[model samples]
Target: MDKNELIQKYFEKSLSPEEAAMFENLLADKEFADEVAFQKKIKKVITHEERATLKDKLRTFENQKTSTDKWWYAAASVFVLLGTAIWFMGQKPDYDTLYASYYETYPNVIAPVVRNNNDTITDTEKAFAYYEKQDYNKALEIFQTIIRTSPQEEYAQFYSAISYMELAKFSEASKILSGTNWSKKYADDAIWYLALLELKTDNPDASRKFLLEASKTSRYQKESLELLKKLD
Candidate 1:
């Protein structure tokens, strides 16, 4: 069978044992092998496109605090300045009122940092310490606990995923990270690992999808974007 037919049959799991053997033999041909690789890439792009909407939602929620804080300052300053200018131009003094209004609507912006009350040192710190000591199993245990107890804890999940990847269990790492519903903090990082797993597993399509999703977040945005560019 041709490369197209072989690939289709492979995906469908409909290839007979003889056909499968023949397909494997065809992989020895450089042109046929390249075609298989190209199909994998296409699959990645398609998967990534499917998750685009979810990725956008995650980004929106994750950046809400930063975006809100930035705009709050800008709007408040503009309102206060405009009010002062108006007062100075012989209009009624409204600077105080405008400032009050702005203050009431927009409190101070404080970025939320993830804190783990369950541990002495932070989970990330502990995980790294264990990792540096070459106690990967211990590090993996701590990271896994953090993930199970506090899935939203970005650094812990990131470290855990890294540990799994380091152990060469890409599928396990990907399974732990795929469709994760945590805040934007570790989501992108997880996506990055998932992409790497897909690449390692020879699933270019899945890798492309993950890279695309990761590109939407600020954490891995630059790297993901660059990867996508290179792929193109």
Candidate 2:
């Protein structure tokens, strides 16, 4: 088959075993891989544009004159919800797929790395710089040291859990995140990541429970709701 045919089948996810092998080989070519990445970005842009257009039309419809419009607006809202449910129903992904979809590394918000001429950065700041650079092993080492010295440092503990998660040390991450006495600032993050960890570990029931709790208060409220729909 031609490369175009392989790419089309890939996007449709209908590749036969032989076509799948061909697709994998094609990905080894830089030009083919760039084409795939470009297609992905184009698809994302189109999806966002379509969603924005739908929302704009819905807003316009709701702003139409009179109490009579309320009934139509209500019907339209129900139709949108049912359509979303049907879409999710057809896209029931496995736990690993769902985890990959939702898991992003937690950012280094606690300490923004500031460059200076002198070598005067603190351990916490240095650790966060490593974390931002995706050097999880070194970051975990420093964070563990900080926790040992000041056990009450919740921010250090929080980032340590993140580092563990990055290293796929799920048990260690779970232990720290599930511990009591997280500060209010990191409590919601811990809950949300615990949900992702459970999903990664293939415990969907536990993941659902944590996601439900996170939906109540985390910054991931919309994501939690959407993931719950997928689980359903």
Candidate 3:
């Protein structure tokens, strides 16, 4: 397939292993490098914009909470009384309810491509597959194991941060991504994610700062530019 077809298939996650290998090899070719760069930029901007819009809507809901009707408060009070009664009667708060609540609060992050040399590729691939399928808990288990086994693996670190982000664990994601020991490839990605996390948390200033730093590097220049434009 041609370069554009290869890129389209890659974005669709439909490329065969051989096709993927060929695409990776083409990253070295200067002529088609611009196309790859553009794709990454577009992906970042689209994801960031979608998430930012959600954040704005969430903020609006939070701001308008005080204006909710009396019936809403009455319903909440009834629920709370029922919950307290259940607690007093020694019945556990339902595990399924808790799990569902947690899932609602924290969505899963997109999984990263795992490297074969630093850890067990099969396990990493399994975790990534689970993440892709939106089975966040299983993916988190594998990511935690990878970090425990190889704390210095930047690929694992990056993905771990993403997992936290997906779960809306912004503070945890920020903490992991803020570290200085990441590989160049992972570091670039981390910076971009960090900027998005800041934006999600309503700290546009910090987001802009992180984006500015990311814009200096060729790897993230296009995305950073697009994000900066949005902030303006």
Candidate closest to the true structure, highest lDDT: 2
Model 3 poorest 10 in a row by lDDT: 98-107
Of the two candidates 2 and 3, the one with more favorable TM-score, higher being better, is 2
TM, every model: 0.42, 0.59, 0.47
Mark the regions of model 2 whose C-alpha exceeds 4 Å error after superposition: 1-92, 113-118
lDDT tens digits, residues 1-232, model 1?
5556677677668999999999899989997887677657655775586457445645554566476575665556557656864566565333233322222111111112443555566766666667767677798898788778887666566566666766766676776677556565455556676766666676655665677667667766666655544433
> Comparing candidate 2 with candidate 3, which one achieves the higher lDDT?
2
lDDT at 225 for candidate 1? 57
Backbone clash total, candidate 3: 2
Off by over 4 Å in 1: 1-125, 147-154
Q: 102-140, model 2: which lDDT tens digit per residue?
A: 999987777754445677988888898899899999999
lDDT of 3 by residue, 64-117 (tens): 667555457545655765686457557533323322332222232433533456
Q: Which stretches of candidate 3 lie over 4 Å from their true place?
A: 1-121
lDDT of all the models against the reference? Answer: 0.62, 0.81, 0.68
Higher TM-score: candidate 1 or 3?
A: 3
TM-score of 2: 0.59
Total backbone collisions for each predicted model: 3, 0, 2
